[model samples]
Target: MGTNTTLKRSLGLWAIVALGLGYMTPTVVFDTFGIVSKQTGGLVPLAYVVGLIVMLFTAISYGKMVKVFPSAGSAYTYTRETMGPRVGFLVGWASLLDYLLLPLVNAVIIRLYMEALLPDASPWIWVIAYVAFVTIVNAVSMRSTSGVNFILVAFTMVLMVVFMILGSIQLYKGMGTGTLFTIQPMFQANMEIAAVLTGATIVCFSFIGFDAITMYTEEAKDINLMPKAIALTVLIGGGIFFAGAYFAQTLFPDVSVFHVVDDTLPEIALYVGGVVFQLIFLSGAFAATVASGLASHASVSRLMYVMGRNGVLPKKLFGYVHPKFRTPLFNVIFVGLVSLLAMGPSLELVSALINFGALIAFSFVNLSVIGYFVFKKKQYQTPKQVFSYVIMPGIGALLTGVLWAHLHADAFIGGVIWVATGIVYMLVMSKIFKRDVTKLGMDAADDLTG
Candidate 1:
């Protein structure tokens, strides 16, 4: 008899939350606080607040879409069902820039953190070790990945809690700005909407993991729980990010005075606590980075597996799962091979592309909710439905699209190149766009019913 060849549903809401937190990497607040502070002109929390509101709408939209089409393809499946396969393929292609490059970004960031603690160690060694370890974890099982995430996310949060307590003490003791709770960090004189929105565009990258929850649709034990899981993941991740930035800003109010903005957290760790606390915080961040990479790698592997099963790629390769582990082993290893780019040149430039790709996919996902509810289902008659399906997602799309427009010109060029490359591949595969992509994708879409 032929095997089912379907992904097994073995995950619950808590595991999903852990994976989302792992991907969001709450410790990233340590990594980006100074940069966002500088970007927002000392209004770090304000930037996060704005990002939180915007992504909440986007997250709600994701929840709406996931309810209609729960699959491993996520944005790809949502767009395919609401729009068409060609557009879906392109959206999925754009999302690939995020899913594929995120691990590399995490790896590079982890290498930097490792260098701070172990200056004598080679960066390649760190990168290779992280890549290998995460690849193995993802290849073995998502449950294993989730187990690691629970521990890593818990440890990451504990470090943040410690930082918050120490920052509060420093504030109480009249260190730094000498204020325990002030709106100064939330706002600055002469700040403009343009500046805050610009800062929000940058901060929005931190909110990308919320949608990763949808990638586990096929693997989730209860489909109804996914919407709640996605919302909870976003809300929880945003709260952690907001709290971390708030406390860090309280500890280090002036970003300009820092010796190095990128390494602000560890330096703050030294000031607020001591060498011991600094090492502890850095270790937490390192663990968080690895956890984030592991979750990202696992998500992208499932994406490739679904795409392969849909015949968008080579079915025989990406569609294969390890019989024992029931994981997308080949796709996981392929992501590992792609992750070697972290050791290559222009890591910053490559990492910069992630925000744009993610924003575009988010915008499309928001639009997909509208397309599904209003266009396809025609359920926009009621006030609640109209608000949820139309107005909110419209704002989500417009805001995310504005952020995408504000991205670096090079990112735009690179996005265009990436999409163009996908288009070329589609043309080649379809014999100059002669084949019917809708029929092809729908056939696989139908498989979801089984």
Candidate 2:
């Protein structure tokens, strides 16, 4: 993408927020419960409501932290400031792993839906072809990628909203699941709260990237506008998540009350709305997944570049921006290659490796918040800031940790391996640079000297 000219910092608050929400548009957890009704019975929607409440509080603390420290290294920088460089590298490195696998996952998901649309189309072809397509989009200038992202997210959200409204109207006429809200099934005799929790961890990941806007500080139109933009993204994104889950529930009321996992249930939307609605839903999902795939690739590349420039990595990638677009073109290519490599495994197997890094990063942020505020109390941050930072982060860490433990073994194992890799990388970098990693980025951003 750097084939031509220089880069500029021009994205506004709306663009940044769009990136976050666009990435989250693929979170279709309600559909999952509808598929797994053998376990949750009736309580699926209730769990979603609980999750929203928990997320709102944690998001408030995250917002505070982002405003307090505006830097490119989102989680990586946040953890480093509070816990030290090693932990920060862990944050950055594991995140690198997460972003690397994203495109692969999304491409596979695209195939999953494509098969539903055209059963004759094989998934392997979809993965390979779609990966190549998204890679090209992201490798170009930010304008093209961001522009496409806006369209994908806008269309997906609008489609979901239309579906929800129509579904609600049908329910009013008793032409649907009858518009009834029943808490009775939530606590049914067979409700597997544990399984729900496990499922919820994966379900919850759909909401993860809402704060990705924080990573664009150096290039953002206004620094202070970040908090408002981020907060709005989370709120609006949550609204969509709820809408997808509840709307499905309302239409396919007993959607989760059965046990059939061979295909997505409560596909009642797809079932009732006929072939056209189903195609719209599936295509929007594909767009949402690819939008996120592209955004995450960009994010990880920028993060890798940040760490690289800070002497935290073996090479200086953070400084490697596209000469033409002024965006991180090298990082985008590297991320795409890694994603392609990960696709060698079964998509189902690789999918398990997906959420671990996210949960760990979430845990680190929660802890980092507490740790940062503890430092702030001593480092001259205000009392109000310190209190909010420490207390809220502490709670976030606790809840996140509990939630993390409930995740699948693959998630936990994937997390450990990624962390270990980060640790080893830092050790090698320390020897190469012959300097402590902690001192890398403390210098002013303007200092370009080695």
Candidate 3:
């Protein structure tokens, strides 16, 4: 009922974890398997392992920062608190590129799936339907959205289990690799490290949702549980990806088996099981899109709400939370409307630009840990503190830096343009740096030591 209203703290550990996993969309491994397998010379699982390792380090940095400043703004809050409002504003603005477009990405994927199912149908219809449904679910209540996400994620995991079992049976029956257990899928005699790293860069984006857990810190019943939730989300999501890729790669060790390498989910399903199973697997993929859409839609809105509350954006619109639903109703609808862009953009084009923003946010969050603890508080007193404050996040910063180096040329160019626009907006908002962009008065040191 009031402009000062906050999001309800109704989400527990499992509920938060469910939203994180839903944001990750565990079933996505199948969609990208063929392309990554081709890139890695059929070592999709190993690439995921590399990606998991990289993401774990960053996840640790996220865990550390959330403990210090538990807010819905996530990287923006961490960066702003440790770095400065200007830098934090830029980071949040860049992160908006990733968060805002993700729901649209899911919608685009759904349209593609529907087009594949019914060749003559209008893809726009599916996009509109998906955006509307996910938007409504998120607008109603955060708890209800989490409940729906849990069911979708659970159903997808069960389907993944089924796929793995069927693949194992096929392997035992003298299929592609002729054995259920083999080091071939993970490593081949002539595999190149460069190839595996390239594949890792591609699949690393799969871990994007883990950091998003931090966005729900304000809504978490126990904020202290956030660090654990962040770690578990990354590990669980990574494990699901690795296991799924392991089975798919083992059963079809050669990428030549697929007719289309770019989009391999349908082919992987059809080959591993049968016609009926392919249909079921497709349904699981659709469920994954819905789950991801709902989670990301909720996350971006909350992030916007935080920015709005800070006066970085229009406070009246983006900052408002529904008294009954306890959600950012306007931001939800705004994201839903933005998702309609799915009708116009190609999946590849939209997908290319996502990692640029994500990598920026990831790199900054890692640096924020060092900025807050090591530089700001001077916490380098002992080996344990040094490790926690410096070395751990230092590694995270370095890994994300590597990922940044591997970003696509198109993505880098697009991201730069987006960041440039944000700079202009920030300059206009601050009236050429004459005043503070945010109204929050809490000092980082006080929050850390309090």
User: In candidate 2, where is summed lDDT lowest over 10 consecutive residues?
Assistant: 441-450
List where candidate 3 sits over 4 angstroms from the true fold.
432-450
Show model 1 residue runs off by greater than 4 Å: 1-4, 344-351, 432-434
lDDT of 3: 0.86
TM-score of 1: 0.95
Mark the 10 consecutive residues where model 3 has the least summed lDDT.
441-450
Mind giving the per-residue lDDT tens digits that candidate 3 earns over 70-127?
7788898899888988788899999999899899988988887887789799889998
The local distance difference test score of each candidate is: 0.82, 0.65, 0.86
Give the per-residue lDDT digits (tens) of candidate 1, residues 1-450.
112456778899999988898899888776766777776777888888988988998898888888777788888888877888889888988898888888887887877777777889778888888899999888888888888888998998888888888888889999867887888878777877776777777677678788887888989999999989999999999999899888877767778667667656667778888999898888898888888998899888988887887878777887787787888888899999888777653433554578778898899999998898899889899999998889999999998877777776667788898889988877776774478665555557676534
C-alpha RMSD by candidate, in order: 2.0, 3.7, 2.3
Error of 2 at 124 (Å): 3.1
Better of 1 and 2 by TM-score: 1
TM-scores for every candidate against the unseen true structure: 0.95, 0.86, 0.95
Steric collisions counted per model: 0, 10, 0
The prediction achieving the highest lDDT against the true structure is: 3
